[model samples]
Target: MSEINLTIDGRQVKAEPGMTVLEVARREGIDIPTLCHHEKLEAFGGCRLCMVEVESRGRTSYAVSCLYPVAPDIAVRTRSEKVDKIRKLLVEELMAHAPDAPELVTLAREYGADRNRFAREASFCVLCGLCVRYCDEVKKKNAVSFFDNGAVRQIKFVPEVAKNECWNCQECFAICPTSYAQAAYLLTEALAFPGQHQSVKRATKAAARKRVVIPIAPVPMTA
Candidate 1:
């Protein structure tokens, strides 16, 4: 791919043809906040925390960095008064779904986002699609997906395939922003074996081969 030259936060950055603005910023050691972008998975752009101002051909517009590709002569601003306000609002909205998440709490504090500004609902899953993407893209299980729509949307686990396969390979659990899988798996175990749910954790750990721990840094809600 041909390389393109652009300016990010007033610093010249050279990037590949397909690289997104967020990718160029990260490569240039510029910190742009993100939540729905994982290096190992495809960018979803579900959270707008990485919004940046892009000036191309004299017109300036805000775009989600994870989805906006780099182009020649484009000027990108990762942070500004406008960008900060948008990031704060995105953090505040995410807090409603993941109020107690360590990453969410940390970002909320950093952005001065009020976690109590909205009503708190009890749910460990933030519906970030990390687990669903991991299952399909990495694990190739095709067993999990988001079900329903809008306010009622939630992950739908295919019990038939999951009961037979996921117990020994709960790798998706490791990538989840919140460990909602632990609770979900326990319920799956109970349904699979009426009296063996109590032993699910022990059995899973004993059979597990790969244990992935995602490190959270002080950045976006995903950290």
Candidate 2:
């Protein structure tokens, strides 16, 4: 790919074509926090935490760095008064959903976000889609997906696939920013397949029974 030139945080940088502004900034050691953007998955832009100020044609505007491609001669500001203020607001909003997430708490401290700025929502999911996208794109296992929409939207595991696949692969758990994906799956398993654990235990016992040979002590005793 051809090299593209862009200015990020007042520093001239060169990036490859098709690279997003966040990629360039990260390459140059510019720290732009992100929630949904993962290197292995497509940009969902679900979380606006990475919003940055972009200057093109002498006009400034906001853009999600992960979704915004780096264009030639474009100037990007990873942080500014407005960008910080916006990020702080975004952090507050996300904190309402996952108030105890370590990453969110860290960002809240950095941005001076008020955890209780918004009413408490114990859903504990920021809807970053990292789990869903990672499971689909990287693992090629469409076990988990988003359900519903708008305010009540949630992520759920497909019962059939999740029962067989999720136990073998919890890769999505690693990518979740709020760490709620595993909890969500466990809750689903409990609700959808109440006997799943019992079934596994029975299977294990049956397997053990097959190996249980009561010892060949009779042959020695006869001798």
Candidate 3:
């Protein structure tokens, strides 16, 4: 593969041809925040958090770094005043719907976003499409999809059945970048088991996996 020279954050860097701007930045130790992006997954560029100002030849504009391939003589600014402002606004908007999401909240705080002016709305899904993409592109399940349109749109597991059409493999839940899977598991246990309890100690110990020491309140003896 041929090497391409580019300047990221004003530092000269060399990256292989076809390397995305995000890759080049990371190789140079420049941190460009991203959501809806994982090293294990393909670049979707759905989240605009990694937007950077790219100047190539005579033209200059903002591009999603994760999707923009690096070329020779490319000048990329990972963080500019305009980019920071836009990222802050995006984070603020995402937070209004998912205020309790720690990852989202952290990113928002990093960008100095203290408030979400948008009215509160109920939405658990971030619409990253990781689930759908993983299913269709990676796993080839294609059992679930995003249905409806506009504000009513959501990650629909199955159109006909209310329950998930998932293969019971838990890939969708596992692949979700947000803590949706953990939250769902907690809710499911609370509702399904009610007073009955199960311990992760048994599962972890039996499997010889890393011990997950979760606190469990002592059960009072029945009178």
For each candidate in the order shown, give its overall lDDT on alpha carbons.
0.73, 0.79, 0.66
Q: Could you say which candidate leads in TM-score?
A: 2
TM-score of 2: 0.85
Ranking by lDDT, best first? 2, 1, 3
Which parts of model 2 are misplaced by more than 4 Å?
Answer: 149-151, 195-223
Please give the TM-score that candidate 3 achieves against the real structure. 0.73
lDDT of 1 at 208: 37
* Residue-level lDDT tens digits of model 1 in 1-223: 6789899999987999898998888888899877667898998888788999999999999999999988999999988888888888888777776676677778888888998887765555677887788888888886677776565767656666676678788887777665665555555554455556566555355223213111111121110
Question: Once model 2 is optimally superposed onto the true structure by TM-score, how far is the C-alpha of residue 50 displaced, in angstroms?
Answer: 0.7
* Residue-level error in angstroms, candidate 1, position 5: 0.9
Candidate 3 per-residue C-alpha lDDT over 1-223 given as tens digits, one digit per residue, 9 for 90 to 100: 7788889989999998878999888877899988777776789888788999999888989999999999889899888898899899888877665655667778877898865577765455566777767767776766456666555655544322213334255676766656443333333333333454442333334222211122221222221
Listed in order, each prediction's TM-score against the native is 0.83, 0.85, 0.73
TM-score of 1: 0.83
As a whole number from 0 to 100, the lDDT of residue 80 in candidate 3 is 84
Per-residue CA lDDT of model 2 for 1-223, tens digit only, reads 6788889989999999988998889888999999888887888888989999999999999999989998989999988999999999999998887887889999999999999999986777788998888888988988888776565777777766776788879888888776677666665555454466865454345324322111111111110
Lowest lDDT 10-mer window, candidate 2? Answer: 214-223
Model 3 global lDDT (CA atoms, 0 to 1): 0.66
Q: What ordering of candidates by TM-score runs from best to worst?
A: 2, 1, 3
